[model samples]
Target: MSNELYTVIPDGSVTTPRGFRAGGLHCGLKKTGRNDLGAVVSDVPAAAAGVYTTNVFQAAPLHVTRESIGKEGKLQVMIVNSGNANACTGEQGMEDARSMRDAAARAFGVAPHLVGVTSTGVIGELLPMDKVLSGIERLPAAVSGTREGSEEFCQAILTTDLVKKEACVSLTVDGIEVHIAGAAKGSGMIHPNMATMLGFITTDAAIDAEALQSLLREATEVSFNMITVDGDTSTNDMVVAMANGLAGNEPLHPGHADWPRFAQAFVYICRELAKSIARDGEGATKLIEVQVEGAVSDEAARVIAKTVIGSSLVKSAAFGADANWGRIIAAIGRAGQPVNPDTVDIRIGEIVTLQQSRPVPFDEEQATEYLKGDTVEIHIHLHQGDGRATAWGCDLTYEYVRINAAYRT
Candidate 1:
């Protein structure tokens, strides 16, 4: 893609540049007549890195891509479809995912293993091969670097997303300019262990497969891994990245002098993408940042923070802006970690809700007023150790229930 932002541009065609071409087309898998199939093809071989769901009931695409990533870190194309998650379909499901890749490989004239596939939406049905294959056949013709094509690509991968999600960042490394652009789809089922959402990031920077994989994993840990929507991981979760070395910079290596600068940019892009997913969470009207400090360990802090964020009671309370400090304390107590309740403290925004083990006197009206904003912060101090961690989540609301209730219909 070009250094210019494409898909999300307000008044332009969704065209990308020469190094990348994307397309989204109607495949009939979705009843809404929205584009349900998309493809992203790199003009040349690119270093690829991916992280898949940790769920045991993995999707066919997850299994296939896992093997491919193990064998070769370079990829040329990705094929994705929405409205029919090829999961729990037995042996035939595996074939369907492979067929999707094989068809894309044929269209792009690349090896089947070099093509990555991802699917989302309704989990138990066989993929409609007629529609999927027909869509794959049209990929060559649909290939375009235009802004309109990029929008189509974003729309095709969406399932229940109310708004299309995208982020872009540019950086200069070694006097060379590089651009990173990404698109993601997630409104529900978004507790990512590896990557609970479907997101793709493309960059023209030159980096080897091994370095790309390392950088991607590091970035994902602090970005996608720290967010939750409903605490439910998906079977088809994936985050794929491609670096086509089109930026004309020197290959990046971990120990190299320029590695730090490149790594920073990589993490910045991943963080932006992760935040976009949280902001666009299904039926979410607010975003919450849960920050934990002074835990037994960084890992322990993360567990505690995620536990608090995942609590239905906590989420509902946050949605209601009830200033329920007891629920927050209760969540921390049940986090399965060694901690002294007497040493625990909690705060909302800048208002201390609980200090040490007792409630702190504060104006309920003031706290409620703070919660009315689109962004809220919850802080916890364990006073037990120096470790700290932060996680992102959204409040629970009736709209969330309504969206998922009729999702498949």
Candidate 2:
């Protein structure tokens, strides 16, 4: 929502003095000496809402934060670490995650429950607590409402990400200005039942817990839930939204007249952040948009869209810049949704690649050129009803395979 155009960078900063101070440090969790720990502390207790991976094998931080969110949609600080997922380490893993939250709460002088914790990296490994605690002790000094701090925070969130992801927008609602800024990190282990996504969104809007939760869920449904890179979800997937109420606007409620505008802003922020994740997907060279139209229902369309986007065959074709419509049709047939194959239509960009279960007469050169772009669109029409859905994905590349194969080594 800010007036600035989107820019690509390996490391960058974003600063919004709306009420939050953030810092990131190198706690030695990562072997590269890059910043791998981040802390976000609000000037005041903020309304918070979160959504975690549906995978039963959720990480300890997710389980603890889920309970905290249920108790109250509020938090004062968040601590995040990268390079070790801390998943499947049993009870000690949970304790270490709790200790991270507890240390942050103590450092910020807030209730332990008001501190949320998250980690990402290799699974089945214990977190390096000594380094994490040392980083926690330095959080206060690192905290700054400045561009340097923001850049550090963004850098601290990386794993296999080739570039840091950030989005921010400022909009005037009800005669008051509000700012929404967010940062996310994810490169591999991506799939829709939440993906490996880790997002932290900060807003200056005044909104209640219930409303914030509702908005975040709806926003994520259209954003994070509709993306896939590797079709593998992570145990540490989590997205959190925090509203510090720095904007003087009246508190937003579901029935309030300004609620729709506020919700739209939230959706925009989430969409931008989600798109950044896809663009920065592990070794991704292109961003793919899968658009499904005219399904039996919207839900069915979503299922089909995700299926097409997640198909390895389809993704591999995209990577090769091959305009293979058969893969798309094959994905649709096996999407587990009711579909009339005879009525399906598929297109790459504006070229109709398939029509009614057969290849349409179109120039392969044009389709290939479109596919070669940084952004690709795959459109499908079921011609059964007036329901539509769109999802985002990235092409599978050899670099992606290389990054993961050598990740643990």
Candidate 3:
């Protein structure tokens, strides 16, 4: 959609922004021979901000990445590998993550501190440095500042994700078209802990490091932090963002006249990517959207919405196309959020199954037809206040258990 504010561009990724180049290749880390290694580099150092998983046992690469961002708030390249999480290998894992950073710096001709590294899959295993370093060396040659290169990078980062997740939008900044885009990879072990998964976003707008960080944090609170998959947080969740001054726009700040426009576009990209991750969750057959409104407060609404979406019973009901509204009501009550028990309303799709906290007659055939779609909506109105929030998740299916049961296989 194009308008005076922002326009959505299809098939966009990190490389859609000016000065960024990216690609990936199979590096033997994955037995399937699919691409498992990828890198993204900016022609010049970019303003950087990163949000990491809140799991107590953090992954090794997260430390190096956090240090890189904290030290200079700038990044030129990011080295990423799938198939090995580089977590719980103790000191050696930290060392390997650092070595990956250095190897990538050498490959991209950037300082070590300017590189950020991340990994996923098979935690508790050390990275195969020989293969990873070799991939790094090949990464520079494979990476191009083209859309195809962006798609390659996208494919390289996936683990159990069934489909690629990418979003892009362009807006006029200082009369110049500035692009903001993002891609993410997540399926299992996903729950909102600051950021629920691994995501990379790039923009061509000239924004201060502090301003960009502020926007990222604010946007993530309502976007990535509102999604859930399996209700388990990962040890390596991170969302890193880079902004290069290639768009030739004046420096942007909190009070900048066009800051809201840029912020909205950035958040839209993040939200779309979040929804895609939820839709593509392991063994997920349908995306579920939970909307909670008329709560006592926005925070209360958020907690209720997330609880409803994260409920296994609710997810199972959605998967089976069952109009069992009791599970949702139970989730809301146990969410610890203040709610008027006598004034609650719940609906599945267009069928209002609960009115005034009581059961309402609904057609089972219509509910089954609605839930059969690829996406489902569960709406709740507390009739308490104007507070509102929305969270996303996927229906729990038998295939989910099967996938995880043999995950290591």
Which candidate tops TM-score?
3
The count of backbone overlaps in candidate 1 is 9
Kindly list the per-residue Cα lDDT of model 2 for residues 1-409, writing each as its tens digit. Answer: 1333222222323347377888899989988899989987788888999999988899999987876666677987888888988889899999998899888888889998888988988899898899899989888888788878888888887898888778776666677777777889887888887977799988888988898998889888888998899999888999988888889788888887778766776787788778888888898999999999999898899899999999999999999999988889999999999899688889899999788877789998988888899999999999999889888889999999888889888
Instruction: Return the lDDT, model 3, position 318.
Output: 91
* Model 1 weakest lDDT span, ten residues long: 5-14
Give the better candidate number (1 or 2) by TM-score. 2
**Ranking, lDDT, top scorer first:** 3, 2, 1
Maximum-lDDT candidate: 3
TM-score of each: 0.93, 0.95, 0.98
lDDT, each prediction: 0.82, 0.85, 0.91
lDDT of 3 at 395: 93
Model 3 segments more than 4 A misplaced: 194-196
* Residue lDDT tens for model 3, 205-312: 999999989989888888899999899988899999999899999989978899888888988998999999899888999999999999988989999999999999
Model 2: per-residue Cα lDDT at residue 76: 76
Query: What is the alpha-carbon lDDT of model 2 when measured against the actual structure?
Result: 0.85
Looking at model 2, the pairs that clash are: 1-169, 2-169
Candidate 1's TM-score: 0.93
Prediction 3 global C-alpha lDDT: 0.91
lDDT of 1 by residue, 190-240 (tens): 885854478888888888888888888888887888888998898889999
